[model samples]
Target: MRELVFALDYEPGCNTVADALAEHPAARVRSLSLHATADRLWRVDHVTGTHEALDAIEDAFLTSDYYADCLATEDCGATQTTRVLDRADNTLVLYSDWERTPACDSVPHIAQDNLGDGVLFETRHEGRHYTWRLIHSGEGDVAAFFDDLAGAVGESAGMEVLRTADTTASMRGSNGTQSSPSPEQEAALRAAVEHGYYESPREVDVAELAEHLDVPRSTLTYRLRRAEEQLAKQYVAGRLVTDEASISR
Candidate 1:
């Protein structure tokens, strides 16, 4: 359950940890700049290296732009040799507060998993700790995961404090559950707010907003359309338009 955002333009630097993770052909790192849920947040995810190779990965995230705005959460599997890393270790892990560990299993989840490495999995949350799975690789992946998680937690804390520090955090999950945006979405909204796009005059085009969001305008439109339909149904039922209006359309 570790997550956060980093430079979309990121490349492995000459750092020791980065060097090692780069050595592994199987190592995979995917960085996504997504729209934040509920509060408009930004998040990044990295997967790479053995436990011995993570010091470099940690270094990269600690210095990334999102680090200043996030608080990471860390969860080392039972066998973790390193004592749990705290938030100060990395703030990018903050994007992970939304995950939950599933019940134990017997079979290998990742068929290609190396025997020497025990699998570790952590769920992620974008808004209020929703459920998304990042399955385990092996013992080799542990160190980086823990380090990444610590960063994730710290980042999450920082974000929560910035946007909702004065307000209580809760998810309205009743069918009344509104669109729960991920941390990525929240980040874009912040940018728009700073740029004066989220204004009464409608300063920013929806497409511009989507570009700033790194998401398709169609996707955002669809989501908003759905949200509007739902809200209209729930809050504006029989008031805004009637069944006769639907027939007219």
Candidate 2:
């Protein structure tokens, strides 16, 4: 199988969720589970932020006609449902299941048409960026999906292809799962390290690094920060597991 990673940038009014995120820069959402068919799409999302940010997101989900870029133009036995499964201090687990009509256009619907079944999708939403990682077969399907997705998005948002690579065993974790650091994040992190941005006396700053990567300064900074967070979490998790094993022994 091959893995295709890409990002979507939504204009202020193009996507309700993106709008809310732009308003609440501290909020973020990650897909826990996602599956899409031509007629329906369902996913469980984990959101984290301040109370105000969570409220904004809930309002957007409940009142908006479309989720993300899935615009519903016709109603043919279509239904949308959202439920908050869990809510804590600053985190919320939300489950959403929305039926797609013939006139609606969505990433999932496009994927179904081009990539077929058994395709895996992972998504993360922060600020105005929607990042997607898809794992599937068929080299031709990747191009098809990208073309269709771009057309569907049209002038509503910008799209960027981050990476495409064969799914090798080394890409997986010790427990046989996808590893941390997405393709985009990895690229940003590697660039910073190579440019001595992390050195005691930094040779390059974020602005310089951003210029080198040909991305906005804000975008480059966000990627590096997120990459650092992911790596730190993985390191802590690994250390905890080792300590547990030693205690058991």
Candidate 3:
């Protein structure tokens, strides 16, 4: 798993990124996501199919201020971080802004397509720069090995990571061994269910939600899905949805 952490100077516009990649017909949109805080700094993480294609995408890529910063962190290796003792309050996020979930061989495409994305919000722990990252790419999974890494980081810090990840996909009903979430995640889960956000809002322009909320559309989606996950914990307890949504089936 190649994990790179850097900062960007632009806003997150996945559609633009998608359109940019679409310029290369052979390359298709894989997955795109955005993370942000009120401070205005933006993180856009996207993975797409390899073009056997773009000869100049890299040129267009590294030229960006964001990509430039990311290249500087190539030497940073937090991929195999193990636990010594960790923090319980620490939160990790699985930024799965992928499209196809490519195979291992396709990891390169993921790396290549996401030229300016994959920013990790991390903190230093015992001298090592611990980060939230993926262990594998293009494994046909939208939400990849986030929990394992979170656990690893917690163990390393000698404290259990309670949230595991800041954003995660909870089982609607019986997906993992863990119990459901607390009332907070539970309420978010209920809102998600009542709003039809999880079943894929038939006509929801998710981007629009951001417009209304005055947040980046990416932010809306993240919060929306995250809330869904919280509710899903209840759906988990209550046996909502179908077996299709359960990872433990």
Candidate 4:
């Protein structure tokens, strides 16, 4: 099995979210996750910048031609629901349960058709460009997949494969342990630490770190937090194992 990460760029107004993001230079969609629950039901998570941008994004979704219906949205700052639709903050994490139209021509649909069951894990919008990470089983020709996708989107779409790698053995550690963060998470953590994110003076802020990583600020923040949590858990588990061994001795 093989894992591939794809970075794709789309034209302006390609979809409602992309169009809304294009209008706000300071606010971008940091990351998005899509899960198809049923025939047309999909749960989507969108991490966006700025409350104003979130409002615009919500508007786009409500009026999008791709989704047949917007099932529901949680009001912002509400702790009751998993959806955060009305968040009036600098960075907003919006969750929506909706249904896609049968004839949807969104990027997700295009990717699903061309990439075969690949997971659209991460996406970031910056300066009218969209970068996406797709992971799928390596059972087909990568070149052929790219060709088909490019042809489907056309030359004007600016489709570029920024990076690709085979991550089949990435889960296994040298000690046969499986307690490491993902490559992307590790990279984010390493960059954050190297930039003095944890320093007393704080040499680098989240915004700077995001810029350095070439990702949205919210994306970096989410990665760093997750990586730290994972590492902390691993450390605690290791210490507990050592203590148990000493007690037995």
Candidate 5:
């Protein structure tokens, strides 16, 4: 198996959800599950943001051509349905089903058409960038697919390849049995580190980071704390396991 990782940057008005994400820069979407056939696609997505941002995103999804039935109403031979599976103060889970037609083309459709069956997809959307990870049997013409997608998107979107590698090797290199951080936690952690929030002198504080990220102080603090706790636990667990193995040897 092979993994193809790529990212797409969408301009405003190019993609409905992308536009919404651009408008609400702090909001993020991560695909929890996705499956696509020739004629249909089903997905479950987890989103995180402020309440206002989530509300706007939900509205865009339900009313736009991306996740709702607008195409069917327009007699485009396509149908879509979406609903909120769960909601919290700063998080939302959405489920969507789409019956595709030639008139409506999506990333999943393009990938399925070019990569063939048994391809697994993982995706993350933040701001105007959508990143994808595809696991396939390495039988597809990746370069041709990339060109096709680039032409399909035209000038409204930009695409780039991030990585390509053996799926098995990638899996083996992953942290063993450690729960990975969620999108929100990972974003916060990354931002904190980049901004020197964890430096000895603490170049930036939580409130300042929150302001820079445009999120509430409480939300940023909570995310940072959770991320820190998770990392600490993982480090200790790994050390203990290593020590035990050394003693046995």
Candidate 6:
């Protein structure tokens, strides 16, 4: 399968949550999922740098043009439910449902038209642009999807294809070799080491690491453990191969 990652910028009048995030530098929408139903539901997961920023986000949900557009589209009824996942880190998770509305011109709808069963793995809002990671069955589908999306959104809104790669091949080195540590694994290991996660004094904990990586704590911990296992296995394999060669000689 192929994974195509791209960034799409909303037009000036096409207000979206991304636009709301652009207005708050201390806030970021980490991930979001849209469900197609009688009431179209959008589950948004986000992190804020401060309580004031969090309050601003809640206010935006109520007053932003994004929700107004949804309400205007097909006489949709809009409602939102929010929860505090982590008060200390300022993480907020919310679900917004637009009842009896047509699909908003959003990334999820674009993927549905193009990729069929493609999965949207990650989404982040930076400035006025929203970056999306989608996994498609093939390259051709992605290309077609891009064309269709451009046609739908018009030329005024900038669309940029940032990166594309085969899911299976991306994790492997050249010539199908298994590298000691994958890029993500290496990054997790480096962060852990640099932050003194391994030190007796423990300069940084798993929560801190997760915050730094913008991932869940469990995710960061899993990657670090996987990286350590890979490094250990590589060392043992190398030693075993050398010992066998010496014995033969």
**Winner by lDDT:** 2
Q: Which residue ranges in model 4 land beyond 4 Å of their true spot?
A: 37-41, 67-86, 96-102, 105-120, 168-249
Error of 5 at 175 (Å): 3.6
Candidate 1 lDDT over 1-249, as tens digits, reads 222221211123322222333443333333332222222233445444444334445554443432212231222121111121333322322232121123211112221122223322222222121222233322344344434443433332221211111111223322443444444445555666676765889788767877877654433443344344555555654444466697899
Please give the ranking of all candidate structures by lDDT, highest first, separated by commas: 2, 5, 6, 4, 1, 3
- Measured with C-alpha atoms, the lDDT of residue 234 in candidate 1 is 56
- Over the stretch 1-249, how does candidate 5's per-residue lDDT look in tens digits? 899977776666766777787778789999999988888888999999999889988887787655431222234566778899999999999998888887766666677778778899898877767778899889878887787777766776667675678877667535454455657778999999999998999999977998999865545654676567768878887898899999999
The true-structure Cα RMSD of candidate 3 reads 16.9
- Best-fitting candidate, measured by TM-score? 2
lDDT of 2: 0.80
RMSD of each: 16.7, 5.3, 16.9, 9.0, 7.0, 10.1
Residue-wise C-alpha lDDT for candidate 2, range 7-65, written one tens digit per residue: 88777687788889888988999999998876789999999999999999888877776
lDDT of each: 0.34, 0.80, 0.31, 0.57, 0.76, 0.60
Off by over 4 Å in 6: 11-13, 32-41, 64-89, 173-249
**Where does candidate 3 have its weakest 10-residue lDDT segment?**
78-87
lDDT at 238 for candidate 2? 81
Give the Cα error of residue 246 in candidate 4, in Å: 30
Candidate 1 global TM-score: 0.21
- Cα error, residue 187 of model 1, in Å, equals 3.1
Candidate 3 deviant stretches above 4 angstroms:
1-46, 49-62, 65-204, 233-249
The residue-by-residue lDDT of candidate 6 on 1-249, one tens digit each, is 887766666554455454566567547766656454333445556656467766666665655433521413222334444444444547666555543335445455556666775454576665455666777677347667788777756654567675577878755633233365656678889888998999999999988988998864534654676577767766777787789999999
Model 2 misplacement above 4 A = 68-78, 169-218, 226-249
TM-score of 3: 0.30
Instruction: Provide the lowest-lDDT 10-residue window in model 6.
Output: 68-77
